[model samples]
Target chain A: AQSVTQLDSQVPVFEEAPVELRCNYSSSVSVYLFWYVQYPNQGLQLLLKYLSGSTLVKGINGFEAEFNKSQTSFHLRKPSVHISDTAEYFCAVTDRSNTGKLIFGQGTTLQVKP
Target chain B: DTAVSQTPKYLVTQMGNDKSIKCEQNLGHDTMYWYKQDSKKFLKIMFSYNNKELIINETVPNRFSPKSPDKAHLNLHINSLELGDSAVYFCASSQGAGGSLDTQYFGPGTRLTVL
Candidate 1:
Protein backbone atom coordinates (compact mmCIF):
# COMPACT_ATOMS: atom_id res chain seq x y z
CA ALA A 1 0.00 0.00 0.00
CA GLN A 2 1.07 3.59 -0.64
CA SER A 3 0.68 6.57 1.65
CA VAL A 4 1.16 10.32 1.46
CA THR A 5 2.07 12.81 4.16
CA GLN A 6 1.94 16.57 3.99
CA LEU A 7 4.51 18.11 6.29
CA ASP A 8 2.60 21.28 7.08
CA SER A 9 -1.03 21.56 8.06
CA GLN A 10 -1.19 25.27 7.45
CA VAL A 11 0.95 27.86 5.72
CA PRO A 12 0.30 31.61 6.01
CA VAL A 13 1.93 33.92 3.53
CA PHE A 14 1.40 37.44 2.22
CA GLU A 15 0.21 38.14 -1.26
CA GLU A 16 2.90 38.12 -3.95
CA ALA A 17 5.14 36.03 -1.68
CA PRO A 18 6.60 32.69 -2.53
CA VAL A 19 5.33 29.51 -0.89
CA GLU A 20 6.10 25.85 -0.79
CA LEU A 21 3.91 23.01 0.41
CA ARG A 22 5.94 19.95 1.27
CA CYS A 23 4.71 16.44 0.56
CA ASN A 24 6.28 13.00 1.05
CA TYR A 25 5.15 9.54 0.15
CA SER A 26 5.91 5.90 0.93
CA SER A 27 5.52 3.12 -1.58
CA SER A 28 7.14 -0.22 -2.21
CA VAL A 29 6.84 0.11 -5.98
CA SER A 30 6.93 2.94 -8.46
CA VAL A 31 4.11 5.48 -8.09
CA TYR A 32 2.39 8.49 -9.60
CA LEU A 33 2.33 11.77 -7.69
CA PHE A 34 -0.26 14.51 -7.88
CA TRP A 35 -1.16 17.79 -6.27
CA TYR A 36 -4.76 19.01 -6.05
CA VAL A 37 -6.27 22.29 -4.91
CA GLN A 38 -9.66 22.94 -3.35
CA TYR A 39 -11.27 26.24 -2.64
CA PRO A 40 -13.77 26.72 0.15
CA ASN A 41 -16.84 24.54 -0.37
CA GLN A 42 -15.56 23.37 -3.73
CA GLY A 43 -14.46 20.07 -5.17
CA LEU A 44 -10.81 19.33 -5.72
CA GLN A 45 -9.11 20.46 -8.90
CA LEU A 46 -6.01 18.87 -10.31
CA LEU A 47 -3.02 21.10 -9.98
CA LEU A 48 -0.48 18.78 -11.50
CA LYS A 49 0.63 15.21 -11.77
CA TYR A 50 3.90 13.35 -12.30
CA LEU A 51 3.51 10.09 -14.17
CA SER A 52 6.84 9.48 -15.87
CA GLY A 53 8.96 12.27 -17.19
CA SER A 54 10.85 15.25 -15.89
CA THR A 55 11.13 15.37 -12.16
CA LEU A 56 10.01 18.99 -12.22
CA VAL A 57 6.34 19.20 -13.20
CA LYS A 58 4.52 22.45 -13.90
CA GLY A 59 0.87 22.87 -13.20
CA ILE A 60 -1.97 25.32 -13.55
CA ASN A 61 -2.16 28.65 -11.74
CA GLY A 62 1.61 29.04 -11.87
CA PHE A 63 2.19 26.13 -9.50
CA GLU A 64 4.93 23.54 -9.87
CA ALA A 65 6.17 20.50 -8.04
CA GLU A 66 9.47 18.66 -8.17
CA PHE A 67 9.46 14.90 -7.76
CA ASN A 68 12.43 13.90 -5.62
CA LYS A 69 12.78 10.15 -5.73
CA SER A 70 15.64 9.90 -3.25
CA GLN A 71 13.85 12.06 -0.71
CA THR A 72 10.45 10.59 -1.52
CA SER A 73 9.12 14.07 -1.77
CA PHE A 74 6.94 16.01 -4.23
CA HIS A 75 6.75 19.55 -2.91
CA LEU A 76 4.50 22.13 -4.58
CA ARG A 77 5.91 25.59 -5.05
CA LYS A 78 4.83 28.94 -6.36
CA PRO A 79 7.16 31.91 -6.90
CA SER A 80 4.38 34.42 -6.29
CA VAL A 81 0.92 33.93 -4.93
CA HIS A 82 -2.25 35.98 -5.03
CA ILE A 83 -4.96 36.34 -2.46
CA SER A 84 -7.11 34.08 -4.55
CA ASP A 85 -4.54 31.36 -4.14
CA THR A 86 -5.66 30.77 -0.60
CA ALA A 87 -7.02 27.24 -0.59
CA GLU A 88 -6.52 23.75 0.72
CA TYR A 89 -3.94 21.62 -1.06
CA PHE A 90 -3.65 17.88 -1.09
CA CYS A 91 -0.84 15.53 -2.02
CA ALA A 92 -1.81 12.16 -3.40
CA VAL A 93 -0.05 9.09 -4.74
CA THR A 94 -1.02 5.87 -6.44
CA ASP A 95 1.02 2.79 -7.16
CA ARG A 96 1.39 1.33 -10.66
CA SER A 97 -1.26 -1.26 -9.96
CA ASN A 98 -4.28 -1.87 -12.11
CA THR A 99 -6.53 -0.43 -9.42
CA GLY A 100 -5.03 3.05 -9.67
CA LYS A 101 -6.43 3.90 -6.29
CA LEU A 102 -5.21 7.21 -4.92
CA ILE A 103 -4.01 7.66 -1.36
CA PHE A 104 -4.17 11.27 -0.23
CA GLY A 105 -2.45 13.24 2.47
CA GLN A 106 -4.26 15.16 5.18
CA GLY A 107 -4.01 18.45 3.27
CA THR A 108 -2.36 21.84 3.80
CA THR A 109 -4.30 25.08 4.07
CA LEU A 110 -2.54 27.92 2.30
CA GLN A 111 -3.72 31.31 3.56
CA VAL A 112 -2.56 34.03 1.24
CA LYS A 113 -3.25 37.30 3.01
CA PRO A 114 -3.12 40.82 1.73
CA ASP B 1 -20.97 22.92 -19.80
CA THR B 2 -20.28 20.77 -16.79
CA ALA B 3 -17.98 17.85 -17.45
CA VAL B 4 -18.97 16.11 -14.24
CA SER B 5 -22.03 16.81 -12.12
CA GLN B 6 -23.56 15.71 -8.82
CA THR B 7 -27.11 16.15 -7.63
CA PRO B 8 -28.39 17.52 -4.27
CA LYS B 9 -25.38 19.65 -3.47
CA TYR B 10 -26.31 19.55 0.21
CA LEU B 11 -28.04 16.77 2.13
CA VAL B 12 -29.18 17.01 5.73
CA THR B 13 -30.87 14.00 7.24
CA GLN B 14 -31.35 12.42 10.63
CA MET B 15 -29.39 9.47 11.86
CA GLY B 16 -30.63 6.04 10.78
CA ASN B 17 -32.13 7.57 7.69
CA ASP B 18 -31.20 6.54 4.19
CA LYS B 19 -29.96 8.86 1.49
CA SER B 20 -28.41 8.74 -1.93
CA ILE B 21 -26.14 11.01 -3.94
CA LYS B 22 -26.13 10.92 -7.69
CA CYS B 23 -23.27 11.62 -10.06
CA GLU B 24 -22.96 11.88 -13.80
CA GLN B 25 -20.21 12.68 -16.25
CA ASN B 26 -20.48 13.70 -19.88
CA LEU B 27 -16.78 13.52 -20.65
CA GLY B 28 -17.26 10.17 -22.40
CA HIS B 29 -15.07 8.54 -19.76
CA ASP B 30 -15.31 4.88 -18.98
CA THR B 31 -14.29 5.07 -15.34
CA MET B 32 -15.97 6.73 -12.35
CA TYR B 33 -14.99 7.02 -8.71
CA TRP B 34 -16.41 8.03 -5.35
CA TYR B 35 -14.32 9.69 -2.68
CA LYS B 36 -15.09 10.84 0.83
CA GLN B 37 -13.69 14.00 2.36
CA ASP B 38 -13.83 14.37 6.10
CA SER B 39 -14.14 17.57 8.09
CA LYS B 40 -10.43 17.81 8.54
CA LYS B 41 -9.92 17.73 4.78
CA PHE B 42 -8.78 14.14 4.68
CA LEU B 43 -9.81 12.24 1.58
CA LYS B 44 -10.16 8.53 0.86
CA ILE B 45 -11.33 6.55 -2.11
CA MET B 46 -14.44 4.55 -1.38
CA PHE B 47 -15.31 2.91 -4.69
CA SER B 48 -14.56 2.92 -8.40
CA TYR B 49 -16.29 1.64 -11.50
CA ASN B 50 -15.31 1.09 -15.11
CA ASN B 51 -17.77 0.54 -17.92
CA LYS B 52 -20.55 0.03 -15.38
CA GLU B 53 -18.60 -2.71 -13.63
CA LEU B 54 -17.27 -2.56 -10.11
CA ILE B 55 -13.50 -2.32 -10.01
CA ILE B 56 -12.20 -0.87 -6.76
CA ASN B 57 -13.96 -1.32 -3.47
CA GLU B 58 -12.11 0.00 -0.43
CA THR B 59 -12.51 -1.04 3.20
CA VAL B 60 -15.65 1.03 3.62
CA PRO B 61 -18.61 -0.09 5.67
CA ASN B 62 -21.29 -2.13 3.99
CA ARG B 63 -23.79 0.64 4.72
CA PHE B 64 -22.22 2.64 1.94
CA SER B 65 -23.26 1.14 -1.36
CA PRO B 66 -22.28 2.43 -4.78
CA LYS B 67 -24.25 1.76 -7.94
CA SER B 68 -23.38 2.44 -11.56
CA PRO B 69 -26.33 2.22 -13.87
CA ASP B 70 -24.30 3.20 -16.90
CA LYS B 71 -20.87 4.31 -17.94
CA ALA B 72 -21.72 7.93 -17.16
CA HIS B 73 -23.58 7.58 -13.88
CA LEU B 74 -22.53 6.47 -10.40
CA ASN B 75 -24.77 6.72 -7.36
CA LEU B 76 -23.98 6.25 -3.68
CA HIS B 77 -26.59 5.02 -1.27
CA ILE B 78 -25.99 5.10 2.45
CA ASN B 79 -28.13 3.10 4.82
CA SER B 80 -28.58 4.02 8.48
CA LEU B 81 -26.22 6.91 8.25
CA GLU B 82 -24.06 7.66 11.26
CA LEU B 83 -22.56 10.84 12.57
CA GLY B 84 -19.20 9.73 11.24
CA ASP B 85 -20.75 9.68 7.79
CA SER B 86 -21.29 13.41 7.83
CA ALA B 87 -18.85 14.63 5.25
CA VAL B 88 -18.50 15.71 1.65
CA TYR B 89 -18.67 13.12 -1.11
CA PHE B 90 -17.03 13.81 -4.43
CA CYS B 91 -17.55 12.09 -7.77
CA ALA B 92 -14.83 11.91 -10.40
CA SER B 93 -14.28 10.29 -13.78
CA SER B 94 -11.35 9.43 -15.95
CA GLN B 95 -10.92 8.41 -19.54
CA GLY B 96 -9.85 4.79 -19.06
CA ALA B 97 -9.34 2.07 -16.52
CA GLY B 98 -6.67 -0.45 -15.49
CA GLY B 99 -3.66 1.86 -15.34
CA SER B 100 -4.75 4.54 -17.77
CA LEU B 101 -2.95 7.82 -17.17
CA ASP B 102 -5.94 10.04 -17.93
CA THR B 103 -6.69 12.86 -15.57
CA GLN B 104 -9.73 12.55 -13.33
CA TYR B 105 -12.29 15.32 -13.48
CA PHE B 106 -14.19 16.01 -10.28
CA GLY B 107 -17.74 17.11 -9.64
CA PRO B 108 -18.72 19.93 -7.29
CA GLY B 109 -19.36 17.45 -4.46
CA THR B 110 -22.33 16.61 -2.22
CA ARG B 111 -22.18 17.66 1.38
CA LEU B 112 -23.92 15.15 3.64
CA THR B 113 -24.76 16.28 7.13
CA VAL B 114 -26.20 13.62 9.40
CA LEU B 115 -27.93 14.94 12.44
Candidate 2:
Protein backbone atom coordinates (compact mmCIF):
# COMPACT_ATOMS: atom_id res chain seq x y z
CA ALA A 1 0.00 0.00 0.00
CA GLN A 2 1.25 3.48 -0.88
CA SER A 3 0.84 6.49 1.38
CA VAL A 4 1.65 10.22 1.42
CA THR A 5 2.60 12.45 4.31
CA GLN A 6 2.65 16.22 4.33
CA LEU A 7 5.13 17.48 6.88
CA ASP A 8 3.12 20.56 7.77
CA SER A 9 -0.54 21.06 8.49
CA GLN A 10 -0.45 24.80 7.92
CA VAL A 11 1.98 27.39 6.59
CA PRO A 12 1.65 31.13 7.07
CA VAL A 13 3.42 33.65 4.92
CA PHE A 14 3.18 37.28 3.94
CA GLU A 15 2.33 38.54 0.51
CA GLU A 16 5.24 38.51 -1.94
CA ALA A 17 7.09 36.04 0.31
CA PRO A 18 8.24 32.68 -0.99
CA VAL A 19 6.61 29.47 0.21
CA GLU A 20 7.40 25.80 0.21
CA LEU A 21 5.04 22.91 0.99
CA ARG A 22 6.79 19.64 1.81
CA CYS A 23 5.47 16.25 0.76
CA ASN A 24 6.81 12.73 1.19
CA TYR A 25 5.58 9.39 -0.05
CA SER A 26 6.29 5.71 0.57
CA SER A 27 5.90 3.27 -2.27
CA SER A 28 7.85 0.19 -3.18
CA VAL A 29 7.00 0.53 -6.84
CA SER A 30 7.20 3.41 -9.26
CA VAL A 31 4.74 6.22 -8.73
CA TYR A 32 3.48 9.52 -10.11
CA LEU A 33 3.31 12.65 -7.99
CA PHE A 34 0.96 15.61 -8.16
CA TRP A 35 0.04 18.83 -6.38
CA TYR A 36 -3.48 20.23 -6.19
CA VAL A 37 -4.97 23.36 -4.73
CA GLN A 38 -8.53 23.75 -3.45
CA TYR A 39 -9.91 27.21 -2.86
CA PRO A 40 -12.87 27.99 -0.63
CA ASN A 41 -15.85 25.89 -1.63
CA GLN A 42 -14.37 24.98 -5.00
CA GLY A 43 -13.14 21.84 -6.67
CA LEU A 44 -9.48 21.02 -6.62
CA GLN A 45 -7.31 22.44 -9.37
CA LEU A 46 -4.12 20.85 -10.56
CA LEU A 47 -1.01 22.77 -9.68
CA LEU A 48 1.69 20.50 -11.07
CA LYS A 49 2.65 16.93 -11.75
CA TYR A 50 5.77 14.81 -12.18
CA LEU A 51 5.35 11.87 -14.48
CA SER A 52 8.76 11.29 -16.03
CA GLY A 53 11.98 13.06 -16.92
CA SER A 54 13.26 16.32 -15.47
CA THR A 55 13.36 16.35 -11.71
CA LEU A 56 12.23 19.98 -11.80
CA VAL A 57 8.70 20.43 -13.12
CA LYS A 58 7.01 23.77 -13.59
CA GLY A 59 3.31 24.33 -13.22
CA ILE A 60 0.67 26.97 -13.55
CA ASN A 61 0.50 30.16 -11.45
CA GLY A 62 4.32 30.30 -11.33
CA PHE A 63 4.51 27.26 -9.05
CA GLU A 64 7.04 24.46 -9.39
CA ALA A 65 8.14 21.23 -7.73
CA GLU A 66 11.14 18.96 -7.67
CA PHE A 67 10.87 15.20 -7.66
CA ASN A 68 13.68 13.83 -5.53
CA LYS A 69 13.94 10.12 -6.17
CA SER A 70 16.56 9.57 -3.49
CA GLN A 71 14.55 11.38 -0.83
CA THR A 72 11.12 10.22 -2.05
CA SER A 73 9.80 13.73 -1.86
CA PHE A 74 7.96 16.12 -4.18
CA HIS A 75 7.97 19.56 -2.63
CA LEU A 76 5.97 22.51 -4.05
CA ARG A 77 7.55 25.93 -4.14
CA LYS A 78 6.74 29.38 -5.35
CA PRO A 79 9.16 32.30 -5.48
CA SER A 80 6.41 34.65 -4.34
CA VAL A 81 2.79 34.26 -3.34
CA HIS A 82 -0.24 36.47 -3.42
CA ILE A 83 -3.33 36.69 -1.23
CA SER A 84 -5.20 34.83 -3.95
CA ASP A 85 -2.87 31.91 -3.42
CA THR A 86 -4.38 31.19 -0.04
CA ALA A 87 -5.92 27.76 -0.21
CA GLU A 88 -5.65 24.16 0.94
CA TYR A 89 -2.87 22.36 -0.92
CA PHE A 90 -2.75 18.62 -1.28
CA CYS A 91 0.02 16.26 -2.33
CA ALA A 92 -0.96 12.99 -3.92
CA VAL A 93 0.66 9.86 -5.33
CA THR A 94 -0.45 6.88 -7.36
CA ASP A 95 1.41 3.71 -8.02
CA ARG A 96 2.22 2.53 -11.56
CA SER A 97 -0.25 -0.31 -11.38
CA ASN A 98 -2.70 1.92 -13.25
CA THR A 99 -5.40 1.86 -10.65
CA GLY A 100 -5.42 5.63 -10.93
CA LYS A 101 -6.42 5.79 -7.30
CA LEU A 102 -4.71 8.71 -5.64
CA ILE A 103 -3.40 8.52 -2.10
CA PHE A 104 -3.51 12.05 -0.80
CA GLY A 105 -1.85 13.73 2.13
CA GLN A 106 -3.80 15.33 4.96
CA GLY A 107 -3.47 18.70 3.14
CA THR A 108 -1.66 21.86 4.21
CA THR A 109 -3.50 25.14 4.60
CA LEU A 110 -1.52 27.99 3.04
CA GLN A 111 -2.48 31.25 4.68
CA VAL A 112 -1.21 34.31 2.86
CA LYS A 113 -1.43 37.51 4.85
CA PRO A 114 -0.99 41.10 3.79
CA ASP B 1 -17.92 23.74 -20.61
CA THR B 2 -17.35 21.97 -17.32
CA ALA B 3 -15.09 18.94 -17.64
CA VAL B 4 -16.66 17.33 -14.63
CA SER B 5 -19.76 18.25 -12.63
CA GLN B 6 -21.71 16.95 -9.66
CA THR B 7 -25.33 17.68 -8.86
CA PRO B 8 -26.79 18.90 -5.56
CA LYS B 9 -23.74 20.80 -4.45
CA TYR B 10 -25.18 20.76 -0.93
CA LEU B 11 -27.22 17.96 0.63
CA VAL B 12 -28.46 17.93 4.20
CA THR B 13 -30.51 15.06 5.51
CA GLN B 14 -31.40 13.24 8.71
CA MET B 15 -29.68 10.10 9.82
CA GLY B 16 -31.13 6.82 8.53
CA ASN B 17 -32.34 8.55 5.39
CA ASP B 18 -31.16 7.59 1.92
CA LYS B 19 -29.67 9.94 -0.65
CA SER B 20 -27.91 9.84 -3.96
CA ILE B 21 -25.30 12.04 -5.59
CA LYS B 22 -24.83 12.14 -9.36
CA CYS B 23 -21.65 12.79 -11.33
CA GLU B 24 -20.95 13.34 -15.00
CA GLN B 25 -17.93 14.05 -17.11
CA ASN B 26 -17.85 15.74 -20.49
CA LEU B 27 -14.21 14.94 -21.13
CA GLY B 28 -14.91 11.56 -22.72
CA HIS B 29 -12.79 9.85 -20.13
CA ASP B 30 -13.04 6.13 -19.61
CA THR B 31 -12.44 5.96 -15.86
CA MET B 32 -14.39 7.68 -13.09
CA TYR B 33 -13.77 7.65 -9.35
CA TRP B 34 -15.43 8.58 -6.10
CA TYR B 35 -13.50 10.04 -3.19
CA LYS B 36 -14.49 11.03 0.31
CA GLN B 37 -13.02 14.01 2.07
CA ASP B 38 -13.39 13.91 5.81
CA SER B 39 -13.86 16.86 8.11
CA LYS B 40 -10.15 17.01 8.76
CA LYS B 41 -9.47 17.36 5.01
CA PHE B 42 -8.16 13.86 4.48
CA LEU B 43 -9.20 12.27 1.17
CA LYS B 44 -9.55 8.60 0.31
CA ILE B 45 -10.80 6.72 -2.71
CA MET B 46 -14.10 4.96 -2.31
CA PHE B 47 -14.87 3.44 -5.71
CA SER B 48 -13.97 3.57 -9.40
CA TYR B 49 -15.66 2.69 -12.62
CA ASN B 50 -14.30 2.16 -16.11
CA ASN B 51 -16.71 2.23 -19.00
CA LYS B 52 -19.58 1.55 -16.62
CA GLU B 53 -17.74 -1.41 -15.10
CA LEU B 54 -16.75 -1.46 -11.47
CA ILE B 55 -13.05 -1.52 -10.79
CA ILE B 56 -11.62 -0.14 -7.58
CA ASN B 57 -13.87 -0.64 -4.60
CA GLU B 58 -12.28 0.48 -1.38
CA THR B 59 -13.08 -0.91 2.07
CA VAL B 60 -16.04 1.41 2.44
CA PRO B 61 -19.19 0.38 4.24
CA ASN B 62 -21.74 -1.71 2.33
CA ARG B 63 -24.28 1.04 2.77
CA PHE B 64 -22.45 3.03 0.15
CA SER B 65 -23.28 1.82 -3.36
CA PRO B 66 -22.10 3.18 -6.68
CA LYS B 67 -23.78 2.77 -10.02
CA SER B 68 -22.44 3.66 -13.43
CA PRO B 69 -25.09 4.05 -16.06
CA ASP B 70 -22.49 4.64 -18.76
CA LYS B 71 -18.94 5.67 -19.36
CA ALA B 72 -19.80 9.29 -18.68
CA HIS B 73 -21.86 9.05 -15.50
CA LEU B 74 -21.37 7.55 -12.06
CA ASN B 75 -23.80 7.92 -9.19
CA LEU B 76 -23.44 7.11 -5.52
CA HIS B 77 -26.37 6.05 -3.34
CA ILE B 78 -25.97 5.99 0.40
CA ASN B 79 -28.28 3.99 2.63
CA SER B 80 -28.99 4.69 6.28
CA LEU B 81 -26.55 7.53 6.40
CA GLU B 82 -24.71 8.17 9.65
CA LEU B 83 -23.06 11.22 11.04
CA GLY B 84 -19.76 9.70 10.00
CA ASP B 85 -20.98 9.86 6.42
CA SER B 86 -21.22 13.61 6.60
CA ALA B 87 -18.41 14.82 4.42
CA VAL B 88 -17.59 16.13 0.96
CA TYR B 89 -17.80 13.59 -1.81
CA PHE B 90 -15.84 14.25 -4.99
CA CYS B 91 -16.25 12.78 -8.46
CA ALA B 92 -13.27 12.45 -10.77
CA SER B 93 -12.49 11.09 -14.21
CA SER B 94 -9.41 10.14 -16.15
CA GLN B 95 -8.53 9.04 -19.66
CA GLY B 96 -7.74 5.44 -18.90
CA ALA B 97 -6.84 3.02 -16.13
CA GLY B 98 -3.61 1.21 -15.23
CA GLY B 99 -0.40 3.08 -15.99
CA SER B 100 -2.09 6.13 -17.46
CA LEU B 101 -0.60 9.38 -16.22
CA ASP B 102 -3.63 11.34 -17.31
CA THR B 103 -4.67 13.84 -14.69
CA GLN B 104 -7.99 13.09 -13.06
CA TYR B 105 -10.41 16.00 -13.40
CA PHE B 106 -12.47 16.51 -10.26
CA GLY B 107 -15.97 17.79 -9.66
CA PRO B 108 -16.85 20.69 -7.39
CA GLY B 109 -17.86 18.12 -4.75
CA THR B 110 -21.15 17.48 -2.96
CA ARG B 111 -21.18 18.41 0.69
CA LEU B 112 -23.41 16.03 2.62
CA THR B 113 -24.52 16.84 6.12
CA VAL B 114 -26.29 14.25 8.22
CA LEU B 115 -28.40 15.58 11.04
Q: Specify the highest-DockQ model's number.
A: 2
Please, what is the whole-model Cα lDDT of each candidate in the order they appear?
A: 0.93, 0.94
Docking class of 2: medium
Quote model 1's TM-score: 0.98
After superposition, candidate 1 runs with Cα above 4 Å error: B98-100
* Per-candidate interface DockQ score: 0.71, 0.73
**Candidate 1 local lDDT, A1-114, one digit each (tens):** 789999999999999999999999999999999999999888889999999989999999999999999999999999999999999999999887877688999999999999
lDDT of 2 by residue, A1-114 (tens): 789999999999999999999999999998999999999998888999999999999999999999999999999999999999999999999987767888999999999999
CA-based DockQ, model 1: 0.71
Clashing residue pairs for model 2: A98-B98, A98-B99
